[model samples]
Target: MSERLTLPIGPQHPLLKEPIHFRFTLDGETIVDADIRMGYNHRGIEKAAEERTYIQDLYMIERICGICSHTHATNFVQAVEKILNVEVPPRAKFLRTVVGELERIHSHLLWLGVAGHEIGFDTLFMVSWRDREIVMDLLEIITGNRVNYGMNTFGGVRKDMNQEEIDETLKGIKILEERTLYYEKVAREESTFIARVSGVGYLPKDIAIAYCAVGPTARGSGVNYDVRRDFPYAAYDQIPFQVITSERGDVLGRTLVRVGEIFESVKIIKYALKNLPEGPITARVPRKVPQGEATSRYEAPRGECIHYVRANGSEKPDRVKVRAPTMANLMSIRHCLLNQQVADIPIIIAAIDPCLSCTDRLILLKQAGEKEGEILTWEELRRRSIAKKPL
Candidate 1:
């Protein structure tokens, strides 16, 4: 038997893009076991929502993920609106879908570029990011912001996408579609890229399911689950697009899945623009929410992001719990990293494109010096939040 030694890859490491820490037990170059710690930057947005008004919480949620800001913002509001039984208009639905899909494209391109960079394929990284500017410009034009579009509001979208904007967006989509096709070819045919990624991070189908992986991570492993197609949020049901998947269950497979999904996103964007209807973009919403709790699910670029909001007939929510896709996908990354080479760590972790920001939360708490800090579950936390007391 080989003696193994433990190594830390985070808290601060080259492999870590965020502040997540990973402890790996390795036998020589191969990882034998792995554990991850995610709370380094815990911001407690869920608990913070209780202290802020419903409108204020929307902005807080949108900041959860810069890449998938639309997803977080939309899902949070969808849950609030559900508690109020407010239905989103068809036009607003399509507009949200347009921005949402555009976000997906931008996110995937960013991931692809980062992945290429991780594998030392800087040429591919440079090209992918250069093309990503098309989507960035389009998002700015549509939402008046680049990173956090702030398109989503309480009942609908804030941005009223005009005909000129639609035309320009369509043109941008066409350009991205062609670029994706080229990337898809390069990802598959380029020997250098394949040599670095193929079979490097393998997550079998059963293992992926057992880990509760979501989004591209699970889809890459042949798990057929996508919140956009399954739950049908934001005119997704009206849009016609296939759920892109891969059977390879490796880093390369996830890459291909994301690239393919971009093409699908383009199709949805074009269709939504062609069929856009005339109506008010947002509905009037009440300031004080009725007492209710609802869960919202949206397929973000990374995976399914869920928001559970509980209102107590007040301006603020009693509890706003978020389950980002990266939380579920984190387990799969541990499994994928096991038995892999130490050098493969960064690329394997990057394959999931883990958003460590969404994994943590911002808590509303007073400083505890000699005072004992008690760990509270979501239920207990909800109680304190409802009472407007500090933990």
Candidate 2:
């Protein structure tokens, strides 16, 4: 009989599973069971929002995830605006959508490059990221930043689009479209790429739906629901696009969904630029928000990012809760890792395109009745929960 052993992947600079600890029970490289733990990088962003005013929280929420910063800011602004009953300017809505799609393109390309590096395909990684710089440059031209565009605000956006910027954005999208076509060909025809991802980490449709997985993770598993399509935020109601999905439900399927989303984003950006309206970008907003609670959702690059805000009759918010896409996808991700060989584990986890920074973390305590304990990081504490040997 094969001996069962535990394998740990940690930030000890070993397996490089940053911000999350994974312990797998393996029988000769065949994973028999797995344990996923959180609480490594929790910053209490949600609790912090309660202390800040509505205006201050906008930027704070934007910092939730660097890759999907705009999505976070937009959704937070939308939730607050709903409480204030403010009608965002038509042009502002369109502009916010443009930046959102641009961020999506940049994020998906980043994921593709990272996925390539995970499987030892550095050439594809280099080429994909090289093309991603075009989108980054365009974002910088419009919003003056690469990572965190800082465009979203309560009631509207901070920056206004001009003719030159619109023309430049269209040109950049064209280049990305052409490059996407080539990458699509490679993904379809490349022998080694197909072999590695195909059938690896198969997440069935039932598991995806049951776990409430959102974004590409849910879509890739044949679940046909997209927040942009169903919920319709920003200018999504005005703009037209299709949700990409696959029945394969494997790592390859999610990759295809993200690639297809890039093309769709290109289309949305072109449509928004062509139909760009002229008007004031920022709307007049009141200092004090009314007492109420609301939820805002956005189709972020990873998946569905939701923000819940509860405002009292004051400048500061009473409560603000955020649920990131990676948190939603983790359950299904664990299921995907099961029954698979250890060698394929890295790519399989990377398949969800996990943003552990967004997953954040929480406190874990171990004690007897009527006792509570503080949380600890790996560096702070070791040899924990040591049971007292039977006396």
Candidate 3:
């Protein structure tokens, strides 16, 4: 065997969109062992949520992930609504489903573009992102913004869809459907893409399950578990759509699964728009939550995203926890990286569509005269931040 080499990628690599460190041990060009170090992007959003009122927390939580802003917003609101025992209107639920599916379309298209770019297929990247603009425009029309669509509130959606907006969304969806179909054809029939992705970064079904991989990463490995279908949150129970999966268990499988989901999301949006129920959009919600804890699960584009809240009969939650899909899927990445060519690193990592910022939680600081690093609690950290004190 050739001499072993250790390579470090990111906390600041051009290929990485966010700060994360990876140490790969390679035997020649093939990776033999891999390790990951995160927390480079920690912002303490959960602690920030604890310091804000429920309404304010909604705004903060939405900022957790820009692409999946609605996902976090909806998930946070759902947890609060659960604590309040508030029932969302049928129309509101359907509308939430519509927006959720739209977000999925935009996110998947974004991922497709990124994946293409990683594989040096600029044409695919350009075309996929070009079609993604259609979904962004629809989102702007419906929710008044593209990235952070402030659609969710405590009880239900903040805005209701009008006939004009519905018509326009349908028009956009039609174009997206046509474009997505063409892309699907490419994913299925394109020889170059197939050759580049097939058998690359293989994550076997058992390894995927054992690693607790979520979303497309798991689905690509034949783990047919979708939060929308299995748990059925929001209006997912009422919406009719298939859970996309692939048994190929490689980069190709993940690509195919995401493409299939784009079609499914289109179907869901069409169904929700056509069969929208007539009712009030928002329900009356109290300002303060009762003493209780609740967990909210959402099928974000990346995978199963969960939010947990503990209320202390106050305006703000006593504890708030968010489990982004990237965090769950990240566990399986090393397995996929092992024995893979070093050139395959980017694509393998991209296969999970990780949002590193969403996964960050804590950052330890070494204070002056302290031998060990200090781990600050949220309250202490907030106090120090307010006082402008260095840890």
Candidate 4:
């Protein structure tokens, strides 16, 4: 009988860029069990949202995930706009769709680079990131910022695409489409790349469905679901694109799905830019949201990002909740890790493209017989961190 050994990775480790802990129990070189622990970087963004006005909340929400800033902000406004009963202008809707798809391209390219680095394919990493800058530059041309575009508002978008910007964007998209095709070819034909990830981190379709995984993590396992097509938002109903999926249920499968998505995003952006409607960019909306509750779902670059808001006839929301895609996809990580070799851990985890910052949350526990849990103030939380206090 082989002796079982336990291996711990992160909260802080060379393998992880974020603060997440994972313990893997191994029998020889093969993993037997895996456990995940989060909460290392909780910022209490949801609780803070309740105290701020709608406009203020939008700014903070945009910062939730630097990579998915527009995703968070767009979803937040969509929920609040539902309660306010205002329809976004057709032109603004198309503009939002354009920015959203550009962000998708940026995110998938970033993931491809990271995945390449994880498997020691630094050349692929470099070229994918080089092409990624093209999208980043296009985002800056349209919204004046690369990371957080701040393009979304309550009734409409904040900026309109001028003729010069539109021409620049179409030109950039042409370059990106050609570059992504090259990546697809590499991911499909590179012998070493395929050998490294082809059979690693297998997550069957049934297990993925049972674990409620989302994004490429689920699609890679043959689950035909995508929020954009399943529940259209912004200009998606008018935009024509296909949901990419794979039946391989492994790291290589996820790579194929993301590459396919980049092509689809390029298609969506081209269609939106060519068919932009002529209308006002912003619609007048009331300062306060009506008393009601609503939810918004956006197909972020990672997966489905959901935002919930409840209002009580005030400038501030009564409650705010967010369900980031990482939270849903993280559930399947342990399953993927089991029975895999230790050397394959990084690429397997990277396959999900997790943003731990968006997944972590503050959890307040109550003692026995206590009906309510104590809430910690910002000052108290800061002080505890400075003093190295344990939760």
Candidate 5:
């Protein structure tokens, strides 16, 4: 009989910067059964949205996930817009698509860097992130902010891209396109990078569909469902681009899909810039929201970000729920982790691009044998760490 060895793989793991724990039941070095535990960074943002007005909830939604901040805000505003029957102008739609594509560029690069770091490829991480700054610089030029570009309002965007800024942005997109091609070559042709990812964490299309995987996770598994393509919003209907997918359904497959997506985003951005209509950036929206319920979905960096809002004819929202892509994608972890070696856990998890902060409340739970011991709040964890260390 094989000895059953239990391993706790996070809450604090070397590969993941986020707080998530995976309890792995291993037969020697190969995992047999895996259980995932999250909620390590939940801020109760969904429940808190009830207290804020519709206008204020825009900012609150943006804070849900730092990496996908604009996407979240865009999704939230779109939901409210649907409820109020507000139609954004053509120029605003174009600008929104431009901003969304730029956000995609930064986010894909960030994921690439983290994936590299997970596999001990610091050179790739550094190079990818340095290239990512070009997009960030472009975003800063247009929106006046790098990470959280608060561009979205209920009716349209707050900022406009003038001719000079448009010219500069086009130049930036060209540079990014060149860099992305180089990164793609490294990911595809380089043996070390390929070996680290290829055939690792194979998420087949059938299982991926069953688990309701989204974004690159689904695309990697030969599922070509993108919110931009399926349900076109903003200027996405007018934009020309392909939804990149792969048949391999492994870590390497996800990498290829993301790299392919970077190229497609460049195409979409260029199209939007060339055909961009001249008009007002935003439209007039009412201060008070009508009593209604609406759902909005967007192709976020990770996957499809769905926002559902309920209003009671008040300035404040009655209920708001954000279904981040990671929430759906995280469901497939068990299927991917089984029968894989212990060392591959981090890279595999990173491939899903799990964002704990957006999905769950961060809580620390202690276990005594098979029974639960005590639930430690994030506050208690901080206090314990401070008590242990004299800092």
Candidate 6:
């Protein structure tokens, strides 16, 4: 009988730039069981939100994940708007949708680049990221910031798109749509991409539903539950776009779904921009909000980003809890990683589009001979590093 072996995949794996450790119990190359340890980058943003004013919390929430910054801010502001019973203007809602879709494009393209790099497709990675700059440029032209758009406010948005900027964005989207089609074809027909992705790290439909996976992770498994469709926020109801889904439930399925979504986002953005309403972008919201609690959900780039906020009739909130999409999808890792070879781990994990900063805080834990030991702080790790006398 072959003996079982234990392997620690990461706290710092090449596949994941973020810090997450996966302990795998393997019989040969097949994983028999897995344990995931996160919280390596926990910044206590939720608890810190309670200490900051509503407006201040917007900036804090945006920092939750750099890729999904706009969605986080939008979700946070939507919660506050609901708590105050304030109705954002139609124009603001349209603008918010535009900005949110732009963020999605950037994030998905970034993921595609990362996934390509994981599979040794440096050319694809470079091309995907190069095309992604179009969306980033459009976002910058519209909101004046590349990553943190700073578009959302308590009641509405801070900026509006004039005719010239709108025209420029439309031109950019046209270019993006063509490039998206090209990438979609590559994802489908490229043998190398297919071999690495198809039928790899599958999260079956039943398991995905049971695990409550959100966004593309759920949709890729043929679950058509989009927050924008079911809940309709930020001019989604007024715009026309389809929720892309795939029944394959594999890494390839997730990749295709995200690729398809780029076009859907373009469709939504073009529609919203063409039919954008004219009005004051910013609405007057009181600095101190009334005592109330509200929850807001948005379809972020990775999946659903939910924000729960409780206002205590003060400038600062009483409590803020964020259920990021990655947090929900992490539950499915054990199921996906089991039976898959070690080499597939990076691509599989990347398929879920994890935001380690949102889900983990880096505190290194030491374990000795199957017995867990003390957790090391960053300062401790720094101090423990050996210094060379001379080189």
Where does candidate 2 have its weakest 10-residue lDDT segment?
Answer: 382-391
Residue pairs with colliding backbones in model 5 are 39-361, 39-362, 40-362, 41-362, 42-360, 42-361, 42-362
Q: Alpha carbon lDDT of residue 176, candidate 4?
A: 94
**TM, every model:** 0.92, 0.91, 0.93, 0.92, 0.92, 0.92
Model 2 regions lying over 4 Å from their true place: 12-17, 361-391
Query: Ten consecutive residues with minimal summed lDDT in candidate 4?
Result: 359-368
Clashes of 3: 0
Runs of candidate 1 exceeding 4 Å displacement: 363-391
- lDDT (C-alpha, whole model) for all candidates: 0.90, 0.88, 0.92, 0.92, 0.90, 0.89
Lowest summed lDDT across 10 adjacent residues in model 6 is found at: 359-368
Ranking of candidates on lDDT, top first: 3, 4, 5, 1, 6, 2
Candidate 4: regions farther than 4 A off: 361-391
Q: Please, what are the lDDT tens digits per residue for candidate 2 over residues 92-211?
A: 999999999999999999989988999999998999999999999999999999988889888899989888998899999999999999888877888899999999999999999898
Worst-scoring 10-residue span by lDDT in model 3 = 361-370
Query: Taking the tens digit of each residue's C-alpha lDDT, what string does model 4 give over 319-376?
Result: 9999999999989988999989999999998899999878875543354897776679
Native-to-model Cα distance after best TM-score fit, residue 326 in candidate 4, in Å: 0.8
Error of 1 at 31 (Å): 0.6
Candidate 5 C-alpha lDDT tens digits along 123-209: 989999999999999999999999789999889999888899999999999999999989999988999999889999989899999
